[model samples]
Target: MTAWLPLESNPDVLTKYIHKLGVSKEWEIFDVVGLEPQMLEWVPQPVKSIILLFPISETYEKHRAQEHEKLSVDPGVFPDDLFYMRQLTSNACGTVALIHSLANSKSISLEDGILKSFLENVKDLTPEERGKALENDKSFTEGHHELAKEGQTVADPEEKVNHHFVALINKNGVLYELDGRKEFPIKHGPTTDETFIQDAAKVCKEFMARDPDELRFTVMALSSV
Candidate 1:
């Protein structure tokens, strides 16, 4: 959330890309990872959700950018915002270490759909276990909604760090926020993630066109630092 690159400086590439929002299911974002091996790996993934790192949010991204170039703005925004943005960018960046860990072992007991199915098909499970399972299911499915609530007001990802600064009413109208991502105000079109990864890869290839060195990585690196 702490990207100090005055939004006025670098044109909002996302806005431009949003204008080109045709029928493609891809993710195009600028996640800064300073010569890090992990960052380089997920560079080509389609990013449906973007936790912008421009201006630079983390210490590593900031440190690298500082060493590589002169920074004209503050890169760090806020701790809460950073944590929240991390959630959004984690999956898109193709590096979800925590998710991968939780997904296994409890694959049949705790995941989103798998657990839901288990509950639905269960005929003799303890009431407490059933309730616990239900609670976990709700938490897992509400990820997007939770993020939207925190981020919607800050149309720009960096601004998400200062959502509290936005006018309450105006904040309610922003898309990344709950008002926009929610079903009522500005419902997002139903976009299946099945093709999302493919779409992201295609877009990356298109952007890097002739640059063979920037080719997509086979492994999805979950961490940038």
Candidate 2:
């Protein structure tokens, strides 16, 4: 069986691919290099979602298991309209993160394109079903594979990578961690248009805390112009 290959974590590349997926240019993405309050000063306002790129290690797996065991993910607590899906294949987490961000971003209108069509088709399906649909989308799936090949030497399809992307979005006054690999959206805490940056920063920091000695974590945000 062929699996999806990992994508390079380049902001420019990511934004370009996001644009190709039909997200408007008005919905820009900016890098958030630090978790400090000062880092928020330069970030554009009305941040909708925060994307986290981190190394996947045994430590992360342990934390994932622990979090799953300890935290009760009340899927219903999240907004009824939130869009989420499961990662059914390896190396597709980046695409999953992009979808999670775009799907939940209410302000950005998706133009007529593959993403819009895909969303329409999967609108009523369950998360697992949506994932299955994605797997079968040749045009969209192949587009991602092409993007993954740019700006770096393409690795063999069997080669494994340790990094993944996860998105944290605020919807209906609540903060949700939308990880395709997770069974359900994780409710971190309350959030709003005014406080989502700070609220998401807290959750991002907790992810860092889980692997304090690891320094491979990166944080970025999707926001209005």
CA-lDDT, candidates in order: 0.26, 0.85
- Cα lDDT of candidate 2 equals 0.85
Each model's TM-score, in the order given? 0.19, 0.93
Q: How do the residues 1-225 of candidate 2 rate in per-residue lDDT, one tens digit apiece?
A: 338867777777778888898988877778997788988867888788899999898988998887777665433555669998998877888888989998987788999998999999999999999888898899778878888888466645688778889999988888999998888889887888888899899999988888899999888888777
Measured on C-alpha atoms, candidate 1 has an lDDT of 0.26
> CA lDDT of 76 in candidate 1?
26
Off by over 4 Å in 2: 70-76
Could you report the Cα RMSD, in angstroms, for every candidate shown? 18.8, 1.8
Error of 2 at 181 (Å): 0.7
lDDT of 1 by residue, 23-123 (tens): 12222234333233444445553223322211212443444345334323432222121111122231121112122211221211332343235334432
